[model samples]
Structures are given as structure tokens and as C-alpha cells.
Target: MSSLNFNLQEMMTVAASRMLAADDVCFVGIGLPSAAANLARLTHAENIKLIYESGTLDTKPKTLPLSIGDGELSDTALSVISVPEMFRYWLQGGKIRTGFLGAAQVDRFANINTTVIGPYDAPKVRLPGAGGAPLIASHCQRVLITLRHSKRAFVEQLDFITSVGFYEGGNSREELGLRGQGPVMVITDLGILEPDPISRELVLTHLHPGVSVEQVITATGWPLKIDADLKTTPAPTAEELYLLRELNARTQEAYAPDGLST
Candidate 1:
């Protein structure tokens, strides 16, 4: 075993970023999804249009946003519209090419949970309720998810389904009349999982550098399946690592106790 230059989180973010194309009109959620989308914009997908639920369109933030309502998003956006217009016109109208999302918990079917940790009425830990996630999952041409791999986060059942993935799996999403293709790629610290075309069950398709199939399976709460043509995800390149580090450093500085960086 040898050491790698980048950490697993960096590899995960870079892997998720690579899924974007230069011309994509992406709806970005906060946390890992925001970081990954911005990384794509700063690197290969320079022309990618980033739409935040805060009503900022084509926002090019200098640092990672604290939330969708972060001032920098509006400050850097090409245009700022009303929330209704943002959703009704841009999202539901089918102008969004991809939706990058994050989740507190996810199941084998790609269903997401961010509402509560336990039973809804009396929960162990209450999480931020779903904002625009459900609509994004329903209307965007496609959806991409990023979250750390862990038994707790990758669960057998969600405490609550904040957003529909494949729903019950198979043609369930289509049967329910969801316009977008449900979560296509789920990028995690350990590897990348993609929904099977036929069954709609998440299958481990690519293992990150230094990660093993056993490790990924052990981290997942469900009986995770393996892709017949499994592959290894290429480690983050020097440029990608440098850019990611710089972005993170800037974010830390911007959100420092004193004030945002100029």
C-alpha cells in the first residue's frame, strides 16, 4: 500500500465534477454538491450555468457558499430572479440539464433523506428539511448525488424520502410521471455507484484509488451490488487538486471570523 497525494473527499469531489459538461445548465445544492459544481465550472466545465435555489442564475462564486442564500451567489450571478420564476421557469420548464444534490441518507434505490434521522414525529436528529430538492429531482434532465460513504449515510431505508430517486425502483419513477431521469451517478468517498438501467438499483461501478470492493460494501447499509464491468476511478490530477485546495482555502478565508475576503 502506498500513500496518495489527495484525500478521499477530494477524489470524490473531482469525480463528481467530471460528470458535468461545458454547456450544462446545472442546479446546485449546497455542501459537497456546490463544491463539486463550482470545481467543474472552474476547471473543465467553464461554461456551465449554475442555478442556485436562492434564485441566482449562472452564479460564479469566488468561494464555497455557506448556504443557498449566501450573498456571494446573488453578487456573482448573471441574473437574479424570484424563487417562483427560478423554479417554474428554469427548473420545471426543463431548462436544467443536471441537478447536483447532497443527502443525509440514501437507500439502494437512490431515494434520499434529509428530513429526520429517525421517526418523523419523534426524531433522534432533525435535519434541514427538503428545500428545492424534490422538484430538482423531478424536473431536471438528470440528477447527480455526492455524499460520503458510510453505513449511516448509505442506509437500507430512509427515515423520510425528501426526494424521489427510482422510488420503488425499475420503472417506478416513470410510472409516477417524473420527467427527469432519477439519480444516475452517486459519487462517494469510497467509489461511484450508478443506477442499473433495468433494475434501477444502485451498483458499485468504480472504486476510488486505494479503496476495495469489500470496503465499499462494508460501508453501505444494504446488500450493495457490484457492476459487472467495475472500474477504478482515476485519482485527482495535479491541476484538479490544486484548484480544489485553492477553492477551499478561499472559502475558509471568506467565512473567517473577521470578514469575507476581497
Candidate 2:
């Protein structure tokens, strides 16, 4: 029996935020990653350095920014530099600690595809494509991905590899000269996945409270690995729920221009 006071999305966001440490220098993306990063900054990690690709360093936004280059990213930032400096002095220089990302598609090896759904030229749908994921995933000390679990999103092979996770797996990233550790954990709506040390394949390590391993397995496209001693993800604390709700309310307020309810 589990006490699920918060909604699944709330639990997922709070669960993702708890993974970050206060001292971490995080490369922020939009959506779930943004929510989780901001939640961490507000609750436990006040000193977390939030870096944006648009050169906003150490920003503290009360509401979620619409995009990487959103005005709030610079307005609330300690200092805003040029995009070149962000990529050169920060990302390539290895100053960023962890990359918080949201992927469109991922494989067993954690290789990501945010580019296209099908073939390169003739595709089902063209996606946003890789912006800074290639660099961030390769250069950051670690990475954390947030995405809803589904067979379509988690596949045996990615349609297009946009970021390097374990590459071919088992020291493949090391061989590729990637500076970072690649993806450390994948936080899904259902549970958490971590890489196997020997195989470098993602394995289900924990299921969210009230979630069954069978549900997660059904959502995955490939034959997923599960730990023999799997554990339940900690339910969101009262404080975590409050903080996340406040953040969400603030985001809604920011986007509601005409004072209409969001």
C-alpha cells in the first residue's frame, strides 16, 4: 500500500528535483527539467548555478521561461554573456556539472533522438532537432533525463541519435573522447532507470510508489533490465508538493497575459 497524495506529474517532478545537489552547476532545458531545476533551487539547493544556452548564468526565475533565450533568463541572471562564451568558456571548458535534459526518444544505451521521427529526408514528423544536447551531454560531468515512459519514446534503436549516452555501451563513450559521464539516471513517470556498470544498458532500479514493474515493462519497447532488489521511489514530501505547486502557479500566472485563468 502507498500514500499517493500528489498527482503523477507532481511526483515525477519532485522526484527529479531531489536528485540534484545544491552545489551542482546545471545546464537547464525547458519543461520537466526546468520545473525540477527551479524546484531544487527554491527548496534545498539555493546555491545551484543555473546556466542557460543563451548565456544567462546563475539565473533565478520565479516562473518558468518560455525558451532558452527568454527575457526572464537574462533579467534574473547574475550576468548575461554572449552565446559564444556560453558554449566556449562554459560548456567546452567543462565548467558545467550536470545537464538536465528532456528527450523525444531514447534507446537501451541512452542514445537520444530529438531530430526526426523516421527517415532523414522523408520523415513522419520533423522535431526540434539537437540544439545543445550533443555538447551538453558529452561535456557535462553527468546528465539526468526526464520523459514519460512509452514504447514509442523508449525504443530498441533510436531513429536518429542526437546525443551520446553510452554510445556503443561499455566504455564506448570513453573511446569517443566524450568528456562527461553521459546519462546517469532517467526519471520517468513510472520509475527511475540507471545504467548497468558492465553492460552500460539502462536498468530499472526503482518504481514510483504504487507503480508496478510490469507497467514499466509494458511501456518499454525493448526488453528492459530490472534490478533483482528493486525499490520504491520515495513519495513527495509535503514541502516538495507545496513548492512544486507554487512554482506551477507562478508559471501559469506568467503566461496568463490577459488575467484569464490558465
Best by TM-score: 1
- Model 1, residue pairs in steric clash: none
Best by lDDT: 1
Per-residue accuracy of model 2 over 92-154 as CA lDDT, tens digit each? 999999999999999998989999998999999899999988999999999999999999999
Per-residue lDDT of model 1, residues 25-76, tens digit only: 9999999999999999999999999999999999999999998889999999
All-Cα superposition RMSD per candidate? 1.7, 2.5
Q: What are the Cα lDDT values of the candidates?
A: 0.94, 0.91
Span of 10 residues, lowest total lDDT, candidate 1: 252-261
Of candidate 2, the 10-residue stretch with the lowest lDDT total is 1-10
